[model samples]
Target chain A: MFAFYTIYKGYFRTALIVQFQYRVAMLIWLLGGIIEPLMYLVVWRTVSEQQGGSVGGFDTNDFVVYFIAVMLVSHATFTWIMWEYIYRIRMGLFSVMLLKPIHPIHSDIADNIGYKFLTLTVMAPVTLLLAWFFDASWRPAPWTLAAFVPVLILAFLMRFYWEWSLAMVAFWTMRIDAMNQAYIVVGLFFSGRLAPLSLFPEIVQRAADILPFRWMLSFPVELLLGRITPRELLIGIGAQLFWLLAGYLFMQLIYRAGIKRYAAFGA
Target chain B: MYYFRLFATYVRVGILGELEYRANFWINIIQSALDLCVALGGIAVVFSHTDTLGGWRQEELLALIGVYFLIGGLIRTLIRPSMIQFMEDVRQGTLDFKLTKPADSQVLVSIQRIEIWRLVDVLISLPVLGIAFLRLGASLGPIESAVFAVTLLSGALIIYSFWLMLSTCAFWFVKVENIQVIFMSMWPAGRWPVNIYPTWLRAVLTFLVPVAFATTVPASAVSGRITGATLIGTVALAAAMLLVSRWFWRVGIRFYSGASA
Candidate 1:
């Protein structure tokens, strides 16, 4: 326990120092994160208004609230480590990382959390700007708000573990571009980045419900926007827990196999 | 004339280099096919819900997709790879070799690297465009066809200039590798008609990112939806951005070469 805490604190401190050095770049990235969801919010709101107040259930204000929630959930859970892993392997940084006493994932988790803490300052104001721009309104029940905390946490863990496992594929393949593209394309469809799962066809919605991607993003956003029923929320949480376990097990297997490959290849 | 020969040489080298790796040809084909499917899938989903997206008919939007792929191919083939190499050179301080060359720096930098395999995007896009044109079911007059060609050229120039300007920022900002991420994020918005976006985003896509000219304007010309004013404006914007990018490239090279000292 003490060793884990020491490694965690050490990684957190290092990430903070590195982020401080490139604060402006981090801010630019934060600006980009702000723009995408805001753009979608406005487009959906326009569509809803044109359709006489709502489309498929979500009204203009519902879109505004849902998208803002999505912005926060996506920011909280998203990982760019797949691209970073490709770079680290290509540039020989992975070897140095492997030599460290601590596991690399501990440092990545610490870095992700640390980076989000720094960027949330920017995201908060941007969220407020979006809310103000769209005149978003939401009134979540106390139970729903209480349920949101654990759902968001599970969503973040599931996303981080799944993407980290995806990144491990870089250890075995020099050409991971095709894999990356495929991952992103599927992620766009499944994770509710393109559109809400509810707005998709019944078949797509069912697939999203069964997959882990919707839990990573759309579930939490829907919960926060008061768009989910209590029964649905319970099912969502149950699904998230199952996927989290699956992702954890998959990560363990992949990491062990990837490390063996890396050791054999001497990289 | 000299630049044409330089481009020919670059293309030949690029093709030969790519040919050495046989697997890369298949990979490129798969990647391009996946890209086409994604675009078509998005269109299918949208049309399934509604007949028109932000006033664009299905056939017209198909033409827009063709222009998107065509210009996308042009960028990947020539502009993106070269700029990426130029940025890498800046990072490694190997740009000095290019600075010593006798040819114009901007031209050389723009054509220095090519992934000849990206011609697949062009090859795939032509058939898509032909099918879209046939679906529109109108016999395009020579005048309209000529206008579409000119607009396509202008749009290409605009995109080239905009990308060159962004890549030139590498001389000043070494960490601008994520600039491509910003561009890629914005490119998806282009997959839809720019008019679908709100006013501010429309303005940004037009005046700021200039993606509207790259895909939409040429597409509008082909669909006979373009106005005289919009056509002239696109041409003027292309010319102005070209000059501005050239000037910026000169300034960037000066800073890189220590001429500011």
Candidate 2:
């Protein structure tokens, strides 16, 4: 445990320095991130107004709150490591990473957190601007707000593990574009980026519930929006825990296999 | 005319290169099919709740989506991938070889790399377009068809110019790849009718991104809903942007060559 802490701290310090060096580039990337959810917010708001000011139990204000919550949850949980891993492998950077004494996942975890911290400056302002422009407002219940922290942490870890596992496919195959596209398309539906899972068909919603994607994004957003009932919240937490364990185990298996393959093939 | 032959030769090379790996073709097909499905699914989800989105009927929106795919495919086939490669060359200082060639630098940079796989987008768009036309059940007059074709060409020109201008910024800014992400994020908004967005967004799409002319204006011409003003405006914008991008490219080339010397 002490060794792990020391490794994490070292990684974090390195990441902080790296991120600070490219803060401007990080800010530009944050602009891209902010625009996607904002675009959806505008589209759904337009739809709601056209539909007599409500759809799927969300009023205009409710939609505002839901999307704002979505913005934060998505920002917190999202990982770009899939693309990073692919690029690193293609460039032979991963080979050097594998030679390090520490596990590569720790550096990635540190990088992700450091990036989020540095980019939050941009995100906060953009969120504020969107809220101001769109007149978005929400009131979270005290308990729900309390629940959001742990749920958000679990969601982040679950997503990080799953995407990291998926990125390992790059070790075995250079043609990961198709797999990445498929993963993103599925994620758009199941992770509630396209719409709330509640608005999807029953089959889709059920699938989303069973999949890890919902726990990665929508569950925490719904929790913060005060939409989930107490029973549902408990169930959501349970699902997140199960998926987190599953993702960790899957990552371990895939990492071992991918490393063995890489060693054999000399990537 | 000479450039067209060069482009054809590049395409031949690209096809030859890709033909060596047959599995890539299947992978490309699956990726493009999934993209088409996601687009159609979004349309289905939206139209489920309403018959019209911003006064665009389902068929009209479908036509817009077809135009979106067609134009998007064309951009990816030539403009986007080439500009991406050009930007990388600029960053890596490999553009010097192209500068030494007898051909125009702009033409060479614009036609350097071809995916060849994006033909799947072109192939998929035709059936989607035919179904939309069938669903509309309206006979297209010759004049309207001619106008649609003209506007479509103009729209393509405008998008190419816009992308060129964006990519030209790499001469000054090495990290212009982020702009591609921003462009794509805004592109989903164009999948729906531009009229559905608010006035500010509509203005942005029309003037700022030029996405309105790329998909919506051509789609409107196809649906027989285009105003005379919009048609003329699109043509004019396309011509102006083309000139501007050419000038910008010249300046960027001069700067790049100067810096290298």
Candidate 3:
């Protein structure tokens, strides 16, 4: 474990330096991460205020806290591997990753961690500004706050493995852009970025509950905001573990299939 | 006549190039469907909570969404793909080919590429816009139609200039493509009326990224929400942005060629 830790430390340090060098790209990327949640934040808040101060169990202030927490949690668990894979496969860069002794995901995981570290400097301050701007209201239970740590880590791993498995589709078709877009659209809906799950229809909420999407992102935010009850928290953790395991198995299957194809086609 | 002939030739060539990639057409259709699901579905979800948001009715908001997709389609079809190519040429040091053309470099770069399949989005959005109008029972007078056309033209020109200015920065900054993400990130904001946002965000949408002019302004014209002052301001801003971007492009080319050195 320590050896694994040291290897990732090296990757993180190098990635941190490279990310720092392109400081403007870093900032541009952060804008995309924050703006979606912020836009939804404004829209939902407006709807709540217009509907006599609250709608569907969340007032304007409650939404303010919900979206701010969402911004942070989404940023933490986000993975760009799907898009990166398309580019890498197009450019014949995946061959280089395959040549490495260690699994390519370890490096990707390290880079993800490194990027989160850099962006949090900006995201943290932005969150504060959003909290101020929206008059966000929340008082977390200390126990729920403690549970947030494991849940967030699980969320990140679940999303990463799932997206990484999706990335392996690059080996089958170089043109996975459409598929990736479809995934993102579904992810956006099921992840509760469109609205809090409570705001959706019973059918939509049930589908979101059964799927891995909510557990990967929105569930962590729900946990952090104390929106999850004790029983629901246990169920949420079970869902996260289930998805994480499923994602791990999916990644193994897809990577094997992808490797076989790459070996045959030599791209 | 020369410009017309040149553009006709480009259309033929672009169509030929697109024909070879038949898969892209299917992909375009699928992606467009998914986009509609998310966009109109979100509107449905929002309206489920309230009747009117920020004083705009549901039909008006649909018109706004139609404008978003229409302008967005146009950009993807002609403007964005061409500019992305121009940026790539800059990175690959092949922009000299564009410079060597008899026509102006900006004009050449702007008309260089077209993903004709992206017109699918425009075709799809037209019906949505029509549905919105039908729902509103909007009767179009000749003057209202003219105002809508004028606003849309000005909006397109404004967006083109803003994007050109942004792509022009490529001569100095090699990775200006990342900067394009700023426009994409802010685009969904235009799905709703800009007035819904805080004053600070409204200013950002209006002035910084120009989404207000490109989408909401034209959509407002269509929905009979545009004021005389807003229409005049859009035209004036479009004209000013064009001139400024043209000037900036010249400066960029000079820098690229080391003429300043």
Q: Which prediction has the highest TM-score against the true structure?
A: 3
Q: Which lDDT tens digits does candidate 3 get at residues A59-154?
A: 888888888888899999988998898778777788898898999999999999999999889998999998888777689999999999999999
Best-fitting candidate, scored by DockQ: 3
- Determine which window of 10 residues in candidate 3 chain A has minimal summed lDDT: A258-267
The lDDT, on a scale of 0 to 1, for candidate 3 is 0.88
Worst 10 residues of 2 chain B by lDDT: B252-261
How many angstroms is residue A149 displaced in model 1 relative to the true structure, after the best TM-score fit?
A: 1.2
Native interface contacts retained, candidate 3 = 0.77
Residue B132 of model 2: what lDDT?
86
The deviation in Å at residue A261 for candidate 1 is 2.0
Query: Could you give candidate 2's per-residue lDDT for residues A178-235 as a string of tens digits?
Result: 9998998998889888777777889999899888888899889888888899999989
* Share of true Cα-Cα contacts across chains kept by each model: 0.11, 0.40, 0.77
Q: Write the per-residue lDDT of candidate 1 for residues B102-206, one digit (tens) a residue.
A: 998888899999998888999989998998889887746677789899999999999999999999999898657778766766765666677777677789888
Chain A TM-score of model 2 versus the true structure?
0.95
| TM-score of predicted chain B versus true chain B for each candidate | 0.95, 0.95, 0.95
